[model samples]
Target: MNAPLTATGVRFADTALAQFLCTNRYTSLDELRQTATAAPRRFWHEVVTALGIQWAKPWTEILDLADGPMWPRWFVGARIDLYDNLVGRVAREDPNRPALRWEADDGATRTHTYAELDQEARRLAAGLAGLGVQAGDRVALYLPMCPEAVVTMLATTRLGAIVVSLFSGYGPDSVASRLQDAGVSLLICADSFQRRGKSVPMLDDARAAVARCPTVRNLLVVARGESPAATPPDGSHWHTVDYQQLIAHVPVTQGPAIHPADTPLMLIYTSGTTGKPKGVLHTHTGFPIKAAQDQLMAFDLKPRDTLMWVTDMGWMMGPWLVFGGLLRGATLVLFEGTPDHPGPDRLWDLVRRHDVTHLGLSPTLVRLLMAAGPAALPDALPDTLRVFGSTGEPWNDGPWHWLYDTVGQGRRPIINYSGGTEIGGGILACFPGLPQKPCAFAGPIPGIAADVTTADGQPANGEVGELVIRAPWPGMAAGFWQDDARYIDSYWSRLPGVWVHGDWAQVDGDGHWYIHGRSDDTLKIAGKRVGPAEYESALVGHPLVTEAVAVGVPDPVKGETAVCFVTVADARRLAARPWPEWERELAEHVGTQLGKPLRPARVHLTRSLPKTRNGKILRRLVRSAYLGQAAGDTTSLESPDALDHIRQCRPAGA
Candidate 1:
């Protein structure tokens, strides 16, 4: 076993995790992970107490594992509500403290203190109840990242209704599908939002979607940008209610309902391998506790810290930030537009202006910012910055080091986090007090029983295999909404009782974990298995290449061959050089970095690759487009035109 590389050489003494260890008398990380994994009930009880999570009634039992690990229920016989823990308790203790800070694309900023936010949520909750929204009714929120979005989420949960948070960037068809699937009764949205300095209409898309969703009875709109005065539809059965008008007549104080701990709280939908989106159900005690624990244990969030993640409300991070930050009494910073809009340094400028303490971003965003050169970066790192966080996809060394050395200034740690919507928070994360490698996680999160396993389901160390969870946590969704069979088949069918997360993972000899890539994207060449991230990393290591995506294509002899699509730093200079020489050189470079057998069959050059709004490269869409097949369910794609570019640049006979 090689010694773990200490790339950053940074550690904190007064972090939340450090305090937890000192108070709990745990000597090391292994002790904490092992104890937490072995005794889930005691760990969660301590966590709830440490976080000061308010409950209407205490549970008699911490966990009921009688249903098996896949369906373990936590907090039996307890009554609680998410709003009570998130807003009620905090607003009572510190009414003047800031709870949320919001900024629009044009630099318009707004601040909401705990008192003001609680008042708004109460008024909105009363107004929603007046509109016939009852407990168990589903309300769809398609608004942009703003104070109203946060208010609506809290108010819905307070009223014991389920929140169906939709992405603001989704089109009419995509919105319609989710609304229909959830049987949503009311929709809250913005009239327009600014993106890249342009007013993007949101209500029109909502109206088009509502025309197909018969369950929606009311449409509440918040006016923004230069949207035309919203007029109630003349002939439609449903009514349009102005957001401000509805809340005007309601009282500013309303108590939240105390439901059982397992009461359904929200439904977050994530796409499956078959391209169909599944609604993942979370409960009062499920998602919020898991998210708060991650912030407390991994990021070491403090009350004085101001955290921001460049994300939209449609993504999991949206609700995650809302509950995680507020529950821990940390101020949340929300931005409602593109991170690099108007200029490449826009995000850096925000960090400086807001004095952001923890800045979270995607590696793809880092690569985009890097393309602007050093001049586009701030002259110095913000003094308030303490932690840099990343998620969404696996990172390559080029961007990871650039973030660690340049953005963090060699003093802060990039808390690499990886998990899915179904997992609630993070399955693996780098702890604040631990020494970190370039892109490696220190270990599995304290409470998660995570491991890498071989094809035969045996635990594998220092080798690549499927990542699986052996124990159930509070965060596992209460079965995919309305589809218990699909939920079991998706995660448990592969391995009898374990949750088979479809990602290729490896644990180094030093016990640090690294995610290779998605297991479904694995390629078999000459009977040897490899992840596309390995090849893509080697290709991006080239000085000229900025980014690359590798896909497996049919080959007569090797069963399958590697084909790469890459974008370069300078397209004009490369075009002027000899094409055949460049292709051969790039292919040979990959072969040298990896083995010869894994060499790409062909290296295709393209202007861009299709990606999601969150900056995840769509390798499946790329392969589909290259093979001239239907690119399934591209509703999540940010730039569908990038697919057209790839198809246009297809090899002569590909």
Candidate 2:
């Protein structure tokens, strides 16, 4: 038996983690690891039983990982479909109970009940079947966050088809890469989407993708903004029937049963920089369990809690929000508009209206809101709000504290969940029982055995190292879509036996985890290493600066020197105040924020930085343009000319 773990006097909210910590159910972290490692089948068996998963067929055996490292069979005898678990198994007492609430950018709102969603999904399943979609067929979904998108996801799951999600804003190249890589046969998208009072042509991008990739057999386009100016000459069709109308045509016979643990629920593509994006395959049982675990343990989500996560269907958070909320029988609030669009109070209004208990947002979004100035935000959160969740990137202490003190009144804990689509859910998350430290992750989840280790494969506590999962969990992805070799090479090659996640991290003496940044993005200058995000985090802490980006440029003595780009809220005001004094004050701000060694060699003020529609700063493009290198893949950029202005602001000689 593993030894017991002490709580160490950390308490924030009333969550399952608090219950686990107080009850001493499992004892120590080692004990939890032992359950996952010692007898993996038995451990998962217990978890599945606890989740009350409705398996159509019983499993004769649990897990068989001994045969090979990659081919681990979970729930060997069960045969069940994911739609059955997601839709059919919900409580029948309240058939009209709301499942999803979608708000469009143009002030259109729609609500779907569990029964409605299930029926619509079945209708779409029948429609897909008519289109020759089979059990193992691949279906590509490039639609926005609407009823059709949710129905398509559920419909594909219902039919045992692999649903590959593509971002609605992805250009032809990215969409083609994902479609070709996944061998997707059918595509679903809308004519266009409204963003910031502009109609963005999402269907045009999809058509362009299909033109490049001939494997796509059919295109199903939904009308959103206006009819497209053009269409494919071949097999293109318009989506006319409402999701409910389509589902009413199909018979609601309980589909063929599948193994609870063996069925693939969803395939979320990873965000790649260099090579082709890898499709991370997640199973029905393991994936949903992890989502539920995180929702309950990290956020303390319950049925009475209404949760909202600002994300699109293409992102991992979209699926995480869906399954986690449904598995816990919680309400999900979805907004289709940009968080800051129409006004900065849009998000705040949603929280107020819905009485959302848990709110999940990106660190970038929080930082952007902070950039809008403190006066732009409400002084406090709604009384119903209990916790805030942060993901995607590591957070700076400034935004973290601002969210905690101003919005939460220092009572709510920010459940920082750090994991990829490949892991289905979080590997490291904040527990409510753990002391709410500003900008620090709580610890590895109870069932997840994770550690921070140096390059030499040695554990490093209170020091920087790579974050790796020491053992496997039920939620681990099967592999990249048809790219098993690449999966093995990309993740397993870094460390012989361990799962390398490629995130730099440090664990404090109290076991608080802090993610530095991506290991691949680490910068080396003058024989000293630093993360670009580290500098950006420091610069954003300044009162005058709203946002910042750091890039490395070649230098004679330093090999590479740091070039910082900052966007101040009112730069003209600062300049009008004083001349050299203001410059010194701003530079001194960076110095005081980050200390000298990590300070930028040069700082340039820019009106705006190039970013994707989702607000991801294009650091590599900024770096490449600064270094006079070709900026590859600029098609997905929100504004192509945004870089032109950034370039003009560069120092004369640089």
lDDT of 1: 0.86
**What are the per-residue Cα lDDT tens digits for candidate 1 across 1-654?**
323444343455678888877778889878888888888888888788878888888898999989887788899999986787788777888888889889999899999998889889999999999999999999999988899999999998888899999888899999999999999999999999888888888888999999898999999988775554477578875789889888998877565678889988899888765657999999988998998889988998988589899988888998999988888998899998888888888898889888898899998888888877875587787778888888988888888888887767777888999988999989999987577778788888888999899977998767789999988888888888888998888889888779999899998877788898899888998788899988888988888788899999899899899999888867777867887788888999999988999999989888888987778898888988988888878777888889998888566886
Best by TM-score: 1
- Candidate 2, residues 505-579, lDDT tens digits: the string is 888766677787788667786566677777877777777777788887767777777778887777667766664
Provide the TM-score for each candidate, comma-separated: 0.97, 0.90
Which residue ranges in model 1 land beyond 4 Å of their true spot?
1-10, 227-229, 651-654
Q: Model 2: residues >4 Å from true position, as ranges? A: 1-13, 19-24, 27-39, 67-71, 226-249, 253-260, 525-527, 577-587, 593-595, 632-637, 649-654
Best by lDDT: 1
For each candidate in the order shown, give its overall lDDT on alpha carbons: 0.86, 0.73
- Residue pairs in candidate 1 whose N, alpha carbon or C atoms collide under 3 angstroms: none
Q: lDDT, candidate 1, residue 172?
A: 97
